[model samples]
Target chain A: MLSFSEENYLKAIYHIEQLQTEGASTNTVAKKMQTKASSVTDMLQKLADKRLVVYKKYQGALLSAKGKKIAASVIRKHRLWETFLVNKLNFSWDEVHDIAEQLEHIKSEKLIDSLDAFLEFPRVDPHGDPIPDKDGNMTKQKKVMLSTLKENQQSKLVTIKDSSDNFLRYLDKKQIAIGNTIKVIAIEPFDKSIQVQIEGREFMITEEVAENLLVEIPSLTLPKVKRTN
Target chain B: MLSFSEENYLKAIYHIEQLQTEGASTNTVAKKMQTKASSVTDMLQKLADKRLVVYKKYQGALLSAKGKKIAASVIRKHRLWETFLVNKLNFSWDEVHDIAEQLEHIKSEKLIDSLDAFLEFPRVDPHGDPIPDKDGNMTKQKKVMLSTLKENQQSKLVTIKDSSDNFLRYLDKKQIAIGNTIKVIAIEPFDKSIQVQIEGREFMITEEVAENLLVEIPSLTLPKVKRTN
Candidate 1:
């Protein structure tokens, strides 16, 4: 049986590897886990002993097949639990992540499988992040950062990369949310700040903020000519 | 935040104290926790330090007020998750305990409270065990052991103290289940076995088996003097 700490380490490693597909460095993992590099080194040895990770000192770690299986299973359970919390338990998007984090470590295949059936196998979590399937496959969807949109281009908010309560609150404060239609009206190249319209009201957003917002081009019904709407 | 093992220890101590009331002995806790007496002593000291358990070396351990609150909160989360699994996720009653055990340790009060709301504030879990309220108070209902029923007395199965899959399979083999009306036709004094009729079928059940079953007698209905069919 995996200890709770071990499961947490694996989860952290799996997520860190997402950004750097070559795998995750010990320093990066230590920083992400808020632990000392020595502590991460000790855990990496243990995980390597357990055949859950491929470790090379000062290089990085990659999940082995067994490790990936566990990671995917954890992801599946986490997203399903989040859906249950939000859709049935009446939890807001902000309230589900922590609870789901704890729940994802439960070692019951039957329970998670049953939950998958219960939620009708939701393809995404409450935060619009794609949920991995039972086989650990996440649906590949096309998305671009809102900052990349040209002036006067129309887009729809498609998803969020983070689901923390603070992140969700920030989105809420900006009146931006999943399914919200947005039109990029102007971009200031000096600071890379963007001005976007929501419900006919214009709002100024920072470059960093725009990069975090994921959007998809709205399908056009007529020939497009760039015009200020 | 309590580790899962710490939460389990607290819950075990709480239950052991419940049976004894005065306190719980190391041996008793060991038996309940399936650990050695030394391990229980070590855990007891840790719990005492945390102000969650009141402990005396040889005498035993009792839940402090703080510990009681924690235990009740864990119970509430457990039952609520069980209800969610069965009602929303379509899990079998026999498959929810181990999953709920892990879910009970989740450290989000809002998540649990929201789940309680989502489950419509269920009064009991799938096993008919009373779910503690948000305040950690359980509704104490009067129940009688099936073994104590008099001859020709009729009652309905309300709950069971044991939730093992083995026990459930055994009950299924005997055609006994929650909500099934039963009539005790005879009590064999020689071995104190119960002969009961379930859904018009008669079977003899041992005293030990009957003792584990919880039954309720409705005041509005008179006891059937004899088996109807």
Candidate 2:
């Protein structure tokens, strides 16, 4: 029965810890939460008192097992709602994030479970982020950045590291999305930008965008030819 | 922009005003919100400052036009979510209320609008409560209590005045639901219990239950005659 603010703090700490490996510093949590460092320190103390986090005065804070479970559940709800918004409600990927943020706070195990069943248990959200299962188990996919692919190599867009509305809109404008097969045509040596062909359309994407787009390399299997051919 | 507490207070005030047909007294609001009278007074003052309610010392409070609009929108969200839970999620009517209560506080206009459309613009929720349109307009259906129908009269259950879980579960046990056609067979004078046939099954329900069940009378029409062989 955590407060919404408490849940949000735990989620922020979990995400920061994922990137930092070590415990998350108060300043890092503050930056992630867009709050003052002093306020974050106060909240960290509260969370520590609740045994949801282990905090050292100046070292950093890390989520306890309890806190990680809560954070995973929150993320699970968020991704599931995003899937529902896009697939059922016909909302575009770029528009579902903010709405899903609010919906993710709805606290009902039954509701979330039923929604998962209704959505056919989606493995990933519209942004290609993995959705944690009911028991908080997430299946992490192995993916490589689009920018790392070799020229003439074929791959399928699988996920996006950056799900900002602007970035999603840009991807939409380029007619790119999850599961679209793309081939790296060439790369500019000066800027490292890549030229790729996706769904019969050729486009050049900047290095920054290419770096954020995750793709799955297709297995190298030779095409079978018909006897008539 | 209203906090969850503020929205809750407004909803309580709106419901109390509907019953009292006057300004909602602090005591009434406290009773509805399960809070102290002092707390209700404090919140009413805050709402007054925001110009959402018109308040006076010990005189009670009434929602301003803006407050009414916000209240209506919250109600709309609650009903829409309830509809989704029951219809889309396959939750029973008795189980959807608390979930909908949490879902109603989600603060995205587009989300609610999309849900309304996704539910195919349902006019009433599973409980027979009217769902307010995006503009805060509600379509009021004309209905009568089941107790008002005479013996041998045919009608369809439309809504329930009481939405408590116990009451809904009772209805479920009796296999009664919205849109079920019921025909009153007889009334017991001693206890005022009525015997009714629902979907070919006969059952006796107390007058109290009947009073809370709203039903719609079908327009009179002659039965079609069969041609002679």
Index of the highest-DockQ prediction: 1
Show pairs that collide, candidate 2.
none
Colliding pairs, model 1: none
Runs of candidate 1 exceeding 4 Å displacement: A162-164, A199-201, A217-229, B217-229
List TM-scores for all candidates, in order.
0.89, 0.89
In the range A1-229, model 2's lDDT, one tens digit per residue, is 8888898899899888866689999899999899999999999999999999999899879999888889999999999999999999999999988888788888899889999999998999988888999778898777888998877787889898888889988988888989889888899999999999999899899999999999985566634435684
- Report, for candidate 2, the interface RMSD: 0.9
Q: Is the docking of candidate 1 incorrect, acceptable, medium or high quality?
A: medium
| DockQ of the candidate models in sequence | 0.69, 0.68
Candidate 2 chain B lDDT trough over 10 residues, lowest sum? B217-226
Two-chain DockQ for model 2:
0.68
Q: Give one digit per residue, the lDDT tens place, for model 1 in A1-229.
A: 8887788888888888776678888888899888998999999999999999999888778999888877877888888988988887777788777778778888888777877887788898877778888788888567888888887787878787666578789987877778788888889989999899976778898888888888875554533677798
User: Against the unseen true structure, what C-alpha lDDT does each candidate score?
Assistant: 0.83, 0.89
Candidate 2 root-mean-square deviation in Å: 5.6
